[model samples]
Target: MKKDSTMKRVLKLLKPYTGFIILSLIFALGTVISTLMIPVLEGRAVDHIIGKGKVDFSGLLFVLKEIAAVAAVTFFCQLFMNLINNHITYSVAKTLRQRAFERLLRVPVKVIDSESHGDIASRIVTDADSFTDGLLLGFTQLFTGIMTIAGTIIFMIRIRFTIALIVIAATPVSLLIAKFISGRTYRYFTQQSKDRGDLTEYIDERISLEDLVSQLGAGELSKEEFVKKNNKLTDSATKATFYSSLTNPSTRFVNAVIYAVVGVVGAFLAVAGSISVGELTSFLGYAREYARPFNEITGVITEMQNAMACAARIFEIIDQDQVEDCDGEFDGEVKGAVDMEHVDFSYVPEKPLITDLNVKVNPGEKVAIVGPTGAGKTTLINLLMRFYDVNAGSVKVDGRDIRTVSRNALRSRFGMVLQETFLFSGTIRDNLTLGKPDATDEEIIEASKAAHAHEFIRKLPDGYDTVLSPSGTLSQGQKQLLCIARLMLALPPMLILDEATSSIDTRTEMKIQDAFNKMMKGRTTFVVAHRLQTIRDADMILYMENGHVLEQGNHKELLAKNGYYAKLYRSQFMS
Candidate 1:
């Protein structure tokens, strides 16, 4: 959606808070009315003293008591309304944040890959937080300020209409100045948000690759790049701050001019005997009271516009198209037959990653895809998982198109173990039972034993309850073993092991291969690996080059053929 329309949509989310807004305005009206009474009562006290030789002490005391009572009531009303506004605001912010996070979870993997992790994180945290602040404080202040200004205007006119006209005349001029400054502030704020997202992306990229950066001696270059992004963010923030800060002092200057004009005109009317001394004094007090609301109104206008910019940014993310889930009833089970027929796929439109790909795996068969780097091995797995749809042709399991099945149901049928393993900050048991949440402690330990992880976990200080902090603790091979244990607990009907054993030492690899053989006994499995000896006994071996199948056969037959597969096997194992 366009930024303006997105902002309007965000405002619509606040419609449920209208009742609280009305109550706040009502409180503001009451407060403004009560404040007007003080000046009138003062004028009356002065008149009573001047009219008679003696002061009316009883009348004076009664007026003072009424003023105190009104003051106390007004204070409570403001406090109560503020508390309500805060509650309403917090509820709305919570709802918005929850929706944003849920949407992120449901979005397609392709959509996630298209944007940087840091950029998405910034939107969820920084942008949404700014939107919350603007929605609550900005909207409440704006509504109340408008009410106060309107109520003050009516009372000031009642006191002395001629002096009231001078204050009213300043309204248009104040609005014009506010409008001019708001345009600049809004543009600067938008730029600032974009720049901040860029800076966050840069930092995330650098930190994740810190070890590689140090190895390459690129520290100086990384620092220079970071400095450039930081400077851009600083410049944009400075411009936005400068423009937004102009609001207060500019409005104050205009108020000062209005005050001088009203004073001169009010004195002239008093001198001509058209107005009493008490009336003129009350009129000046009304003028000052009138300025207070107008100043508030101006400040609210400035703040709301600034908040609108933030709202626009937050809505932009919410407005983007998320992956549409295929509609169906699913029971999270599937027959293991797999097929890819005449499939063509691409991450970019102009460059095809896989072309005219045709492959099939019978139920309970073990197949290995052997390929060099960038030969579309992972892309094929991604397509089978429906992370990205094939540009042409179809992928099917048990004669049913994968796209026809709901994503969750289709994904639940398969387990995956990748080369690079990630262990979240938690107990070893917590990581093991992630997929099979309902599994018993016995089941978890059994799976861990099958993956050769239970013995090592038992050796830890806290055994299975040992907590692993992300920054310290586990070695790379140990993390891989934990992930394998997680996949074991899942026990899906089909599995994909993409270089799963490559990270471990040769001795550990042989141990894990024994576990893998046991796990694949009756399940369909797709193994993608660079090692020639890993898949020497597979049911079939597919040698792929530039997305095409170069050879296909059992390992011994392929080596006997003296073709591309033979050449590759000789280069590695026969060396």
Candidate 2:
């Protein structure tokens, strides 16, 4: 995106706070006016002191008092301006983060799946902070700097037009220097921001899987990779800082030269009786004041460039294409009868994963999908849940096309338990009641008992109130049981269990299987299992390979046919 367009978008976000901004600008003007009066008052005081005996003590006292009063006003106005600027900067940052998060929630699942989770997080949290810092600089320094520069120019011209023109003529040198350095620094800062996000992503992944790395004896390899990413970030940051740092000194050098020329000319004018000594002193002060804004603004050029880069990244998320949702509403209850007609789907167009798939499941039947890795078992679940729309054909729930229904309405009918379980940082009761927030204590205990998780819960220090995190002490099997208990509490009409009991021991698995059998009695359930024995009672068992359902039947039926299903079953038990 072009820099001007990106900045325009950022300013649009600030439109809501226009009233605060106007008030701050008013305070800034007061600060500049009061500050400009100080130099003039000090010059008058200087005029009162001619010779040791000729000093006008009374006049000096009066001028000093006026300077003191103006200084106090300047301080208060500046304080209020700073307070308002802080409020606006942080508020804008808060709004940006909220919008980014909302956009993340609405974007297509594929968008999230394609990007690094940590990189997305960095754009929201880290990038937003950097942008706000730059914005604060703009509000605090840039606005006031412009006002001060203009005030000083007016004051200087009133004192001596010839020297004032000299100051004005040199303004372009400082601006040109700042512009040249700032332009070169932007690309480096952009690269630095990108590298920082990449490093953050790598670190997040490695830190989350540190245990796995240790177990697999890949610690050294992980460290080497991290070092490479870190070095890349370091290099980019070094180059960006080196270039941006030039703006301040380069502009300051030009301003210093202009100040020297003003001092020499003003001195000659005072000697030639063109201006009073006190007036010459005041003019020099105004010249210094004029140069100060340029120095300060150029000094902040680095932060401004970085802020633009980060803002661009944050807008990338806010501007993503959202998942298309239908406005059609479903009126009646979902009975869990599902059908997929001539379904075709693929992540990539050239590599089709599932094609010409047709399946019909009754309202309360248990269907078991058994397949090798990457055989599209999980894709089937994604389709049923409408996580991804099929390339061709439609999936129907209770004779109504699912694509016509709102996504939330369609998904509310099903419950899922996957092989990888998730437990947030909250109490056990909190995690259990996620699906049904209004569940009573008795209902919670009953569900926990059904999933065989109650016995272990009773032994914990706080039982249902025990806090759990993803890295909590609970074993994988324990977490899976908690997930199952959560589902039991909600008891949706349909269920999808993808290797749901894979982490448990055979004994505990058998107990959970009993609980599952009871739960599956009247609910339409789709089970993806690797253990053939666990799915023996399924009404229909699908043996899938390379996205095709090669054989499907009951235990005795498929065994009798001695086809693909039988061979897989024999290989599992017979081996």
Q: Evaluated with lDDT, which candidate comes out highest?
A: 2
Q: Pick the candidate with the highest TM-score.
A: 2
Clash number for candidate 2: 0
What does each candidate score in C-alpha RMSD? 2.4, 1.2
Q: Please give the clash total of every predicted structure, in order.
A: 0, 0
Off by over 4 Å in 2: none
lDDT of 2 by residue, 1-575 (tens): 66777889999999999999999999999999998888898789889999879999999999999998999999999999999999999999999999999999989888999998888988999999999999999999898899999999999988888899999998998998899889888788788888988989998998889889999999999989989999999999999999988888888888889989988998999999999889988988888888889988986777888998899989999999988998776777677899989999999999999888889999999999987889889999989988889999889998899999899888878999999998899999999999999999999999999999999999999999998877899999999999999999999999999899988889988888898999998999999999889889999888888877888788889999999888888899998
> Per-residue CA lDDT of candidate 1, range 181-237, in tens?
876687787788788889999998898789899999999999999999999999999
